[model samples]
Target chain A: MFSRDRWQEIFQTIGKNKLRTFLSGFTVALGIFIFTVLYGMGNGLKNSFNEFFMGEATNTFSINPGRTSEPYKGFKKGRAIEFRNDDIDDIKKDFALYLDEITPVISFSATARYRGESNSYSINAIAPPYGDMQKTIIMKGRYVNAHDMAGFAKNIVIGRLVEVDLFGHSESAVGKYLDVGGVMYRVVGVFQDDDGDNEERMIYMPYTTRQMLDQGTDKINEIMLTYNTDIGYAGAMAFDLSLQKYLKAKHNIAPDDQNAIYLRNMADIVQRNMMFANILQLVVVFVGIGTLIAGVIGISNIMVFVVKERTKELGIRKALGATPASVIGLVLQESIFITTIAGYVGLVLGMGILSLMGDRFKEDYFISNPGVGLNIVIMATLILVFFGVLAGYVPARKAANVKPIVALRDE
Target chain B: MIVIKDLHKSYRMGTNSLHVLKGLNLSVEEGELVAIMGSSGSGKSTLLNILGMLDEADSGEYILDGVPIRNLNETKAAKYRNKFLGFIFQSFNLINYKTAIENVALPLYYQRVNRNERQEKAMKYLEKVGLKNWAHHLPSELSGGQKQRVAIARAMAAEPKVLLADELTGALDSKTSYEIMDLIQEINDEGKTILVVTHEPDIAQMCKRIIHLKDGVIVEDSFVEQVRASSYVQ
Candidate 1:
């Protein structure tokens, strides 16, 4: 296949018509470039979305209280609804077998101070299961436990950023006392979240201790829950709906009052996101194929002109005892050579640009690392070869069918 | 080496059919240097085409080297054309893009000879035509006489049984024409059968025999006192 004479002939022919060859090759290269970039960008966008939901559980949902939209019994429609500790205890006791983890949360912004250095941070009071549910990484010490909550101890888990704020990085903040909201609390643990300092600006403590610190109010802000959902989307939604009804009954809200109890189904959002990603992938493939077809058409058009130009030469070859297959092979080989080389060049350039852009946009969730996989590269190579063959076929056939006598007489 | 019996050919121009070759019967034995001569539209070109196997007769028997050349497929016909017949055209129809040596090597390429062997054979033939020094030059770079010599070298490289020349000097001056004829005569002296198709009486007189055609029939077929092409001053 790498015969020197054949290669010389191909190069000579291509060299004679430099502009035509370059234009045709450029179209194929452009098509491949667009294909690689579009598909890579599509996957990158989907990856960014997945990154947002990575640390938190996919099967988890949260419940938050809202203003009653519909009255029940003697309750007014505009009445503000709020959750209590008793509701959290009842839900945990009743759904303990079905639930994976459940936690009650109450948060408020407060100042953390150790000696002279002080910085404002959000204070989160949660149960022991909160750390495991939110995938929080404990840097030192332990989180608030059942014993701490039962005894209503003033123990707090400071975020890693809060630790740095209250005490310098050289000192350990755990086992030290920090003043939070004018109350002294011992730091039980130092932890971090996936988003680095963004999540590390908050601190955690026992919910019971927070309630006592807040002047004897038993009101809880929200309840976070996760359940086993191997039974799929419909079954999970059915369980969620039943749990919503149970919450409605406990809160004395009217049945079918949708605004009274706000529920966020993270599992449903994950499923919807996966569906959108699949559709995006299909769209990229379709557009890529369309561009490839246009490139192939451009190649065929140029090949027709080339075949016409070589009519006399082909006739001379045929008279010299060249077989039809040999004549056809000449044309096909040129097309394949041009397309494969140009397509490879385009692939490399497109991927290189994407890699640079990915680094530039690293801080944004809209686009992540945009690049093609090995399978896509392999598939693109095959498609380029196929396009080469398709583009060369008609002109090659015309050259093969040329009669030596007629062609020789042609001016 | 070549035989034709009752050969007929025609052309169709829309509604009109022009019968070119009426009932031609001829044969040329081995080692014969023959020339077919006639005026324009006398069907000599058609006869040359049929004899070269570039075209088929409507109804006739054409044989070469004891093999009946009738109804052979394109592949078989091309094979026989390569092995038995070599053609030199009036315009010195060498591929313009190829260098002189590459043009000479082309037939050998189709014969599936390896690259080294083809190059060696092509160089030897170029030397025979006395154009060895100009081999690497393209056809465009060579003069009319040099181009014809390159075409002759290309034809001889295949080592075919019969060499066919169609007005081989029609595009050259009288001096260059005779010089080309001198080269053709030298090739024929080596015992290769050759057919020269021309309209010039002086050119036909240079051959050992002349067959004159008129209205698609042979009017004369006779041996002559040959005038050697080299005897003409260049």
Candidate 2:
């Protein structure tokens, strides 16, 4: 079936009929080209959604203190509520099965001086588990540990940008001392955050040290924790309601008060954004398939016309002792060859365009690094070529079965 | 060599059938140059089509080179046609894109001849037709006589037992017609059985035997004094 002479004959025909070959090839190429570009753009949009919504830990909740709006149990309305380190132990003990990790945050702004380079930065004094909840990536040294908290040690973990700012990119900030608000704190680590430069510009220290600096009080500004993921969405929502009620009762605030304790659940937000991204991808794939179908139709139409055009030549070949099978093989092989080559050309061109446009559309169009996987595009091309064979086969069979007498007769 | 007995053929034109060949009987021996003569609608082409295995006789006994040609499927018929008969059409019927030598090599290619031998045989045939220098030229680039010569070379390349020519000179001027007829006579001198279908009396006189047909039946069959076409060709 794979004869060099047959291939040579097909090449001669194709070379002689340039317009016919180009017409058929252009249809297939254009079809795959549109499909690749659309699929890549869809992936880019999904990437953007992921980068925006998935920057931090998804199965987490953070609660902040607010002024009470209702009076309850002798506590007057308009009373300011506060969370302390003891509340962390209470939640951990009460919800041990549902809680993965918990941390307290004491936020303050301070100007730090390291060798005369000073910058005002937000400082969060936190426990060790805060590193997991925030998904912090440590670049140098280590985070604040239990020993530092128990000893009330003045050790801090600075952000990546903070290190560059204080040390001017010439020195490692780890193990170096920086004077902040008249107190000297040794930097123990440098960390980075995917949530962009804002998270990368802050500093972290032991909460016990911060509490000691504040006259040894146990006051904390906020509480953060990640729940066990095996508890699905419904379980997480139930946990959120229960935690809210417990915090309200502990702070002596009214049950229906909305301002006493503010809570944000990352799981619910992530789920909603994920659903939107999936729907967007579905729409893109639907359009891509439509393009491929149009391409198939286009190739089918061209093949029919080509067979009609070659009726006389086919008659001559048949008269010269060409079997019906040989006639069909010639046409079918030519169709497959053109479709496969043209589809590959379209795939390569689309990928090249995507890489050249890399991240240029991210800020304006929410399409980041637009491209499709090689396996996906190749599979799509093979499907198109398969359909191309069907398209060529119908007309080829018709031409082959035509009686030479009828075919050679003047039209 | 060829034989036919009680050959019958018809065409249905939308319910009404037109009988083309009605119970025809004929025979010819090897090396005989025979001409079939008829006017339009006289079944000359239809008879030639059946003889060439391009069409089937509805009910008849037909044999070529000792092989009975009846109830044969398309593939078997194609093989028989390729191995036992050669055809020269009025319009030349060359594949326009292929060069003369490639066109000549087509039949040998179907016969499974290797490339080098197919080329060598095609070149030999082109030399026989006095067009060896035009072997690489496409049909469109050749003149009418040269194109017909290429078609003749292509038909002869397979070396079949019988050569069938259907109005082989109909599309050419008288001078070129005589030249083609002269070539046909030279081939017949090689002991190959040949049948020429034509309406022209002069073309028929060039053959050793002539069969006249009318209204789908043989009206006359007789041997005539052969006129050599080479005497008239310049």
Candidate 3:
């Protein structure tokens, strides 16, 4: 199997028949190239899906209060529902085993001024855990903590764009005093949001401070909480249903009310989007495999033609004392060599093209960082080579087993 | 040395069978230069094919160099052909892609000889055929006579016990034919057993004995006064 003589003979044949070798090699290379590119693009599409639907925490749920549309327990059908601070404590005490973090949000738009600059920014008053839920990357100082909430401290965390607008780009926004709606607040942190520019233009503060400024009201505009991930998807769904039921009952709303409360479960959206992405990837893989099969058939056709063309040469070799096994070995080894080398060439070229086009198609085509894993590409190449051997074997065996007299008789 | 007894061969042609060799019997002693001659379709080629082990006889006993050649598989037949027999065809079937030396070294390569020794032996055989300077030239670059010389060198490179030439000079001109026959005679002079198959009377006259076949059976078997091909070389 490791005969230098055999390899030398193969190289001589390949070198002498440049066109024949190139034709067969080109078929295999194109197959693998298309396969790699298709697979990488599929992965890119999945990346885009994940970024769009699952950029924030998947375990967190946001519940917003709305007007009640169904009457229950003597409440009118058009009653306006509201979430109070006591509801947060009730949910925490009831779902303590399944809850990870809880936060109440009191959002309002306010004009913030610092020295000479002023801009209207949507300000969200929340707890420390809200930073994790929103996936905020703190650039300077820190988030609103428990001590600030307890003391109702007028400390604020500004978004990146908010800092740029009111404080300008030249100076740090942290530890600076900013005026919001006639109140002076000290900026404790400056942060960035991956959810894009709109999120980066907002500001955050302690909910206790916002409530104190609201004439000591205990009302919250929205409630957000993260559930323990040890509970799987099914458990998360069940928890969502139970939490909705509990909230509706506490508000004295109808069980089947359409508009009493609204719940947005990130887990459910993430799961559905992931399913869609997987199906798309499967389709791409099938197309890739089909291309590979076409390549195998292409190489097979070329090999059959090659063997037929070399009938006379093979007869000469047999007459010179080449065994049937040696004849088969020669053709099989040549096929494997050509396929392996060509497959690698295709893989490298495809990967190079992908890297060169990295993230360029992210906005228009929803294909982010398009590329394939090395292990998968290598496996695909090996499969093609194996088929290449089969393609060569069938024809080589027929030629090898042919009698020299019959072969010589062929013109 | 070769012996064939009661050899029979047939080819199936659609619904009928054509008998090629019908119960033929022949024997050649060591160092014999024999020529088998006949018209086309007289089974001369079929006989040569059987004797060279390229085709097996339907019912026959073939013994070459004290080894029985019956019911041997492809590998054994190939080994025997490599070790005991050398063949030369009219077309001088040298692999076109290979150089003269590479073509000559092919048989040695099949014999599992090391590269250096194979090249040395191939070069020696090329020198024997008076083509040592043309050893590195491709077959396409050589003349018909030179190509036949390379083929002959390749056949002899394996050091077989017998040399079989089937119309060895058919593709050459009258002068080149005689020149090739001269080389054959020189090889036979060195005590090598050789059989030349040809229909040409002049070619037959060059051998020490001639067997004429007609319709798959021998019509005449007789000794001849050998005409040295060297005398006609000019």
Q: Residues A128-185, candidate 3, lDDT per residue (tens digit)?
A: 9999998899989998899999999999999999998887789999988999988999
Tens digits of lDDT, candidate 1, B64-114: 988888896667667888888898999888998789999999999888888
Give the alpha-carbon lDDT of every model. Answer: 0.86, 0.91, 0.92
Query: How far does residue A8 in candidate 2 sit from its true spot (Å)?
Result: 2.3
The DockQ scores of all candidates, in the order shown, are 0.64, 0.66, 0.79
> Of the true contacts between chains A and B, what fraction does model 2 have?
0.47
TM-score of candidate 1 against the unseen true structure: 0.90
RMSD of 3: 1.3
Q: Candidate 2 falls in which docking quality class?
A: medium
Docking class of 1: medium
**TM-score of model number 2, chain B:** 0.99
Q: What lDDT score is found at residue A289 in candidate 3?
A: 89
| Chain B TM-score, candidates in order | 0.97, 0.99, 0.98
Candidate 3 Cα errors over 4 Å, as ranges: none
Report model 3's chain A TM-score: 0.98
Q: What's the CA error at residue A110 for candidate 1, in Å?
A: 2.1
- Residue-wise lDDT of candidate 2 within A123-225, one digit each (tens)? 9999999998888999999988999989999999999999999897879898999998779999999999999999998899999999999998999999999
The alpha-carbon deviation from the true structure for residue B56 of candidate 2, after best TM-score superposition, in angstroms, is: 2.4
TM-score of each: 0.90, 0.94, 0.98
Which pairs clash in the backbone of model 3? none
Give one digit per residue, the lDDT tens place, for model 1 in A305-348.
Answer: 77887788888888888777778888788878888888887788
User: Chain A of candidate 2 scores what in TM-score?
Assistant: 0.92
